[model samples]
Target chain A: MIGRLNHVAIAVPDLAAATATYRDTLGAKVSAPQDEPDHGVTVVFVELPNTKIELLHPLGEGSPIAAFLERNPAGGIHHLCYEVADILAARDQLEAEGARVLGDGEPKIGAHGKPVLFLHPKDFLGSLIELEQV
Target chain B: MIGRLNHVAIAVPDLAAATATYRDTLGAKVSAPQDEPDHGVTVVFVELPNTKIELLHPLGEGSPIAAFLERNPAGGIHHLCYEVADILAARDQLEAEGARVLGDGEPKIGAHGKPVLFLHPKDFLGSLIELEQV
Candidate 1:
């Protein structure tokens, strides 16, 4: 079951501009950009009182977000991550309910270094959902 | 300054289906659908530990989300709402920094009955941002 609303990921064409808007324009505490080559993204964390907003930019060739960026040139909300207590259990339950889990139905280490699994957008009202074990 | 992330609004074509997915599939506490004729939306609130996820469906003629649903028939993340201490001051400062506030640059009563203003998506990397005075 989903616990906390982990973080909202926004894939942006320009990371600096997105970071500046959140940091300066919105006056939020934003972290320095960190390159996650494994995940194929450069992420900047905007810390909020209750949750986090992650600004993501494609990092290298064949980046996961590159295709998303192409479809959304101006960038958009990519996915919503929710904390789960048990990744494997959650996956099993979701699969049983006929909800498709992405990536071979296996949990992978996410950007936050937590075991995470992505659910198919088709089963989730076109909203990509990431379930992270916290 | 942005404080808490009040809620993330997801525009959906089918409110009942979306609510069922969040409540049963995702195992989150979801509220009953509340029709807001004034806002032209019927919303179901998924209450998370940190914040809320609002599932919106077009309510009446000229519904704001009608166009969005037409574009994304399966539904999608519509906007993000962040709480602010002083909305007028926040708007003034954002405008000063060249961030275009949506509408007539005046805060209106949002779904939660709080003063809120929407920022232009162009000035925010294609993400519609709502600032609500808390």
Candidate 2:
């Protein structure tokens, strides 16, 4: 089952613009941009008191965010993440219930340096759902 | 400033199916459906330890969720809601920073009985943002 809302990721065409909106415009604390090659994204974290907003930009031509941006023309809400105490248990439980986990059903290290898995958008009502172990 | 993440809303074409997915499949605690005639949405809240997931469906012919579902065909993440300590102060600050608040720049009572205002998706890197008074 899902735990806390970990982070909401927004895909943006320009990472710097997105970062500035949160940092300068909103006056929120933001982390320096970090390239996540594995995820094919360069992300900046906008920290809030209770949760963080992840600004994602495509890192390469094959980046998933690139594809999303192509279809959307503009960046949009990319994914919603939840924390789980035991990811394997959660994955198994979700798998047994007929939910499809993305990427060979194995956990990958996420931006937060935690084991994370993405569930197929179709299974999650057209919204990509990520589960991270915290 | 954005406070806690109040909820992440998903627009679902079929509210019953979406509710069953979270309740029966994920074993999440979900609330009964409530209709907001003014907003033209019928929503159900999935309670989590740290945040909530709002399952939204079209309540009338003019419901915005209807348009989103028409384009998406499948339900997807609609928007993210954050809590604010002072709605008016947050509004003024956001406005001063050039972020356009949607719906005449006034806070309306949301499902949680809180005054809430929506920010333009275009100014937010394509993600609709809702600020709610806590």
Which candidate number has the best DockQ?
1
lDDT string for model 1 (A62-98, tens) is 9988999999999999999999999999999999999
- For candidate 2, lDDT tens digit of each residue in A1-134? 77788888998988899898888766678999999888799999988877888999989769978878998767898888888888999999999989999989989888779999999989889989899999
Report the number of the highest-TM-score candidate.
1
Instruction: Find the number of clashing residue pairs for candidate 2.
Output: 1
Residue B22 error, candidate 1, Å: 0.5
Chain A, model 2: TM: 0.93
Segments of candidate 2 deviating more than 4 angstroms? none
- Indicate the residue-level lDDT of A34 in model 1: 99
lDDT tens per residue, model 2, B1-134: 66678888999988899999989877789999999888899999999887889999999788877878888889888888888889999899989888899878888998778899999999988888888998
TM-scores for candidates 1 onward, in order: 0.99, 0.93
| lDDT of candidate 2 at residue B109, scale 0 to 100 | 91
TM-score of 2: 0.93
What stretches of model 1 exceed 4 Å from their correct place?
Answer: none
